[model samples]
Target: MMFEENPPSSYLTRAAHSEDSQETITAVSHVLQDQENTRPVPADNSKSFAASGDLPAKPISPQQRLARLRLLMSRQKAEYESKIASLEQRHRELQWEIRDTHWQLGQQRQRHRLAEMRIRDAERAKEDAERRNEMLQKEMEEFFETFGEINRWK
Candidate 1:
């Protein structure tokens, strides 16, 4: 059986389903049973494999299978760690972006408030100037009337 390309899980599934010889099926089943019994329990850290460095309970003389399994486990662990690091970095970047957006929003709000205040101030100044102009015009009218009367008397 050329199962070099397929993973163990798929290989086992294919073997189990195919119409292979009874002896082959029995041998594969025994191997799978042994693997299940010897599989290490999952742990929180990557050091789990290092902590339990014991070989399988039924050690096969052909070290190829054991070495292949170890290689697969290591590759899986490395992939998971890489994914976790990438996600952590992405999370940090998103947090910084959120903070920057919040700061920009606050700045825009402040600027909007300042603009509103300036508009109000400008309107107030315009009203005050109009009132002063009205007062000056009335005073000038009164002075001109008084001057005309004095000139008529002269």
Candidate 2:
């Protein structure tokens, strides 16, 4: 588990500011541009094999090659489907995790709100107590003054 003190934007800024990363990005862009300029050569039956001066050996008939291509394509399609299914499963898991995190955050917010309310109530109670104490002190002072006058008259 990793504890992150800073927010996501800071990490993004750090990544964007790296000089080595910029050079790497430029290199990758150039490589991709070169790839865009390159084209695949079509299969030519008349082309001579590079290793041998003779024509390229035809391993299978046209029909057999077509069947092979179909099989390969189907295999690739199935592989892609499996990959997609796994990716979808992972996406669902991530979504559930996000939902759970949001729920936890909501619960925390509710708890914090409740705590704030309790604190406010406590503060009000403290004020009321202080006011009551002051009133009692004033009453005690008045009682003492009345008792002193009565004693003086006696």
Candidate 3:
């Protein structure tokens, strides 16, 4: 519709730098829509709005269009910043969760090491107990043999 009203030269000059992305297309559409929404100077070339709309037109010159676009851009920028702040907060929360998980893993490793040491010490103690029992059995057998031989001689 804009191409139909405005000459190819006017629109093409502005659109020359735009690419095919949807966002870029949408932004261009918004500018085109904004420019078209203004009242065309009354065919008689008078500056008054009495001929058509109840309110005076918003953009009459290149400067006016620039100002209007600046205002729109500023508003969009503020919205983007607010959304970014929320994302940044989420990022920080994720980082904290990562730290907590790492700490828990460290604690698990320490507990595992302690359990291994206790098991090793228990095995050594068990070996020592077995050796002491074997020695006691040998000494008791020797005492019984000696006492039995003495009783027999008497």
Candidate 4:
């Protein structure tokens, strides 16, 4: 009677004004369905709705709820900030360790190269010494042969 000949607009206004009995029933049913689908928020006790904190177990005013939500958000933000700081510190440490490792590896490789060069030089010197010894032995044999010939003539 109030919305004579304007059924759709009347339904929309009723839904908006929270006046329709059918809309209220549907809303309540949907809420129940959602509750059935959801896992319970961990409560201190089965009867209490509060989590494991000092917050109220029963429903509070809207202002108190808003304050609690803000506190939870701030706590989460602080935790994220702490985690990021720790990760950054660890990143810097790892970078320094990598650089140190690289430097040490380079020095070790240089020392190894120098040792190889020294070994090559020592091997060459040994070969030269062996060749000189062979040449001296040949000279000594020739001298002895010539001395024997000279003594025979004498």
Q: Lowest summed lDDT over 10 consecutive residues: which window, candidate 3?
A: 1-10
Model 1 per-residue lDDT tens digits across residues 1-154: 2233334545445555777656444545555555656666776545544455654455544245545555655776687789899999999999999999999999999999999999999999999999999999999999999999999999
Clashing pairs in 2: none
Candidate 3 residue spans exceeding 4 A from truth: 1-72
Over 1-154, each residue of candidate 2 has an lDDT whose tens digit, in order, gives: 0222332224334545777765534433443334334535447634535643453354444354335435645665687789899999999999999999999999999999999999999999999999999999999999999999999999
Candidate 3's residue-wise lDDT over 22-134, tens digit each? 54444445565655676475565355655454664564554554466567556656867888999999999999999999999999999999999999999999999999999
The better-scoring model by lDDT among 1 and 2 is 1
Model 4 C-alpha lDDT per residue in residues 54-120, reported as the tens digit of each score: 5454544445533543564466568778889999999999999999999999999999999999999
State TM-scores per candidate.
Answer: 0.53, 0.57, 0.53, 0.58
Candidate 3's displacement at residue 60, Å, is: 10
Candidate 4 Cα errors over 4 Å, as ranges: 1-57, 61-63
Q: Local distance difference test, per candidate? A: 0.69, 0.64, 0.69, 0.65
Q: In model 4, which range of ten residues has the least summed lDDT?
A: 1-10
Residue pairs clashing, model 1? none
Poorest 10 consecutive residues of model 1 by lDDT? 1-10
User: What TM-score should be assigned to candidate 3?
Assistant: 0.53
TM-score of 1: 0.53
